[model samples]
Target: MNNKVITKEAAAELIRDNSTICTVGMTLVSASESILSSIEKRFLDTDSPRNLTLVHAAGQSDRNRGIQHLAHPGLVKRIIGSHWGLAPKWMEMISGNQVEAYCLPQGQMVHLYSAMAAGLPGRLSPVGLNTFIDPRIEGGKMNSCTKENIVEVVKFKDKEYIFYPSIPLDTLIIRGTSADPKGNLTTDEEAMKLEVLPAVLAAKRFGARVIAQVKYLVEGGSLDPKSVVVPGDFIDNIVICDNPERDHRQTSSWYYDPAYCGKIRVSPQQETSKAPLDIRKIIGRRAVDFIKPGAIINLGTGIPNDVIGQIVKEKEMESDVTITVESGIYGGLQSGGIDFGIGRNLSAMISHQDQMLYYNGAGVDITYMGAGELDRNGNVNATRLGSQCTGAGGFIDITQNARHVVFCSTFTTKGLEIELNDGKLNIVKEGHIKKLVNTVNQISYSGKLAVEKSQKMHFVTERAVFEMTDKGIMLIEIAPGIDLEKDILQLMEFKPLISEKLKTMPMNIFTA
Candidate 1:
């Protein structure tokens, strides 16, 4: 299984025209930028694979720059990914019908790759049973151009499960922090856990070629055996990308700078507010309720950022709770909010593969995530909207395994205003649209699975608290001074089952 180690250009040559390629990266964290660049250069120089199919857990690189460049003019014909917001230009192409796009749940994509690697016919699960990902409703539909194949629906233990078939890969492209001369790779610096080895194994099992991009090369035996995530036997080609600054989370000893937020472009409809109290700080405090002492936790981007800070404020659980970022940093204190926090005490900062393996196996105790929309069935749609959405990022892997999951987001968006004063919430302006909907454009997480696993799940927003029940999603409480009809019902596309004992959330959150 000796493979060839070559330059980026040499690796790019292996990707032929009209090929079905699988790239390994979970979000902007572990993407193989150099290899993507090589592919882009080849695509621009020659008319390569006109009908290219991309299969991955996450979409393109940060901000969609890499995938955008490759799929721009006549390069890519179609794309099948869990999310595509990394590249807004591609969304434009999708909207125009110039490029085809298919959206699947992020966890489903990971399971698909796992099935492909294990030589299974496909993945069998109840994850997307009655949701949009179900074969019945467009079969994980993304746009007019792309459509997924829903193999069948079968009864198991008198329950139903939808079968999503495996799609073969012709090529697998991955990025790693370092590799040895023999092709062993490790990604200790990335944030999110990616299915790098699974991608390579799946490609190889199907007789597909594997292309890897690395930052440095070490001696054959230098990499600790325990740390080698991708062995040389599984890799077919290696491209050395010398740039080290691209990695988002570096070693704690090193001075790490947060990724530039770029431009803060809020949707015109999104309401902006400034209060004496940072809403993010309060949100972080609320997340602390989900944390348990001596538990490992994964924090998603956005509102979940507050979890780390809130957890730190308690200070008592600092030694007990281990906080990790999906970007691959483990241990220490993880700050919450957009800027993200640092881990104070340290344990082990492992690579992307190790993180995924641990999380996928349900090694984590709790995970906090932010959602764009959640439905009555408990399906989460954080990836796509009408024409724009970010990559699934690490939402799938983290939530799938965590014992307890918390999704925090405002109940409504777009000029819906609320004020907390004198221990009461005052509705300033009604939000224009409902965030909790009857159906979502995409299924990023399955509520049914949460119920099956008896996982603790909560939907926390400023206005209400809801939980998933066997019957459906149930409303447990409303914020203080919030009207059930005016604030809750008017803001939700669907009515949640309410009990006579439903209570008003305490204004003094700490006392509640």
Candidate 2:
């Protein structure tokens, strides 16, 4: 039998210069770190495989590791991915115009892998019609260096749709927990099943090399057929990484957690504590109220993810509703910080591609997302922040089709401080930056489109809450101690319509 196993260095040698490499990873959960490091080392030593284009569906870095290993200027010439906030190196390169960067919706980017696997020209959908992904606005280009138009506005049957053309793939870097002698891969110990199958298929269908990174290799027939995720016939090379502590981690911080991979089940009650009541908790407590019993929900990063998941667990609502992460985790205690994509005690796990498709189909009843900025027109900018371009991950796709969207954010940012006394919120120091701006730098969520679809929307903050109306964004709720005119209106760039019967935010939300 021909041996598919090879050294990580040998696997790195397989990649050619100027080739397009697609990887499957959600941060460091399923990251091929050993192989990626080997490739980076090879590039640094020989500079043989230079000017490569890297593609991924989700943010694949924990700021320093994962894809950041290949962020050198000459090593990567272009990057086509969903998120960049985790990888500051790529952000620096993109900001410096050293590479061509295109930021597509995370869902669309995942589906594009399937499109490439199917040998389709491109994917046509209405997911990114009016947002920044629309060619009429920016065409998903992150900088002036990005010149090619990969996304185009097309009309099908009298309706408009965004078409994302598939790029030719040359190499696929994917990870699994184990590999059999015949090269079948299984992710039984990984945090979540990423888009590995599609990435392999996309590479093999296009005659590209498939590099598989596994924690260990099993004997022939030792692996169950049902457990195999990627068959050996498609994998060109296998690189075994034995170090789970540093190289192969369940998540960035977690070396290995049985609960994260469903090897064992743990109750949410065991994982959480009574979190201190703060601005985040206040927003999360208020946002949790929007979640109706039995509603299917998607929670974005930051306040929504960090606080709301804890609130749900604290409230013991795990069985009451289904929560999904874009990383393909179904239901469990969703993690926060660098371990955002993974969860423990998951109900189910699917491919990221399939999960994105589910979200694009409007499978979510309501979605709670964080916002970077909000304009008077009700447009939300979660992409560009200051001079840095943190591409829209799955925010565009998740929010666009959800029946209802509740944006959880702070009224102000950059050193905003508050104190909770009794049931009142006292702003000690106002934030230097106003989140409510006159015009957002870029529109991640279109208000005009939301109004047209009649999607119910709400903006929840520590001090104020606003709801989207046909006329405009209307102030509906204010914190108990906040002055409507002095605290809220004066901080925003434009005046918001006030509801005649505006009420104080539930006092319970302010309590610890």
Per-model TM-score on C-alpha atoms? 0.78, 0.98
Per-residue lDDT tens digits of candidate 2, residues 1-512? 45788988899999899899988888777889999999999988998799999988899899989999999999999999988888899889998999999999999888887888898998999988889899999999999989988889988899999999988889989999899877888989988888888888878778988888888888888998898998889888889985768898878988888988888998645776777888899999999998888998998988877888789888889778899888888887788878887887888988788888899995599899999999888999999888788889999999999999999999999999999898999999999999999899999999999999999999999999999999999999999999988899999999999999999998988886
Task: After the best TM-score superposition of candidate 2, give how far the Cα of residue 289 lies from its true spot, in angstroms.
Answer: 0.9
Give the Cα lDDT of each candidate. 0.68, 0.89
Candidate 2, after superposition: displacement of residue 53 in Å?
0.8
List of clashing residue pairs for candidate 2: none
Q: Compare the candidates by TM-score and give the number of the best one.
A: 2
After superposition, which runs of candidate 2 have C-alpha atoms over 4 Å from their true positions? Answer: 267-269
lDDT of 1 at 182: 77
lDDT of 1 by residue, 67-137 (tens): 55566656777677766655677667777778766666566676677788899998776555545566775
Residue 497 displacement in candidate 2 (angstroms):
0.7
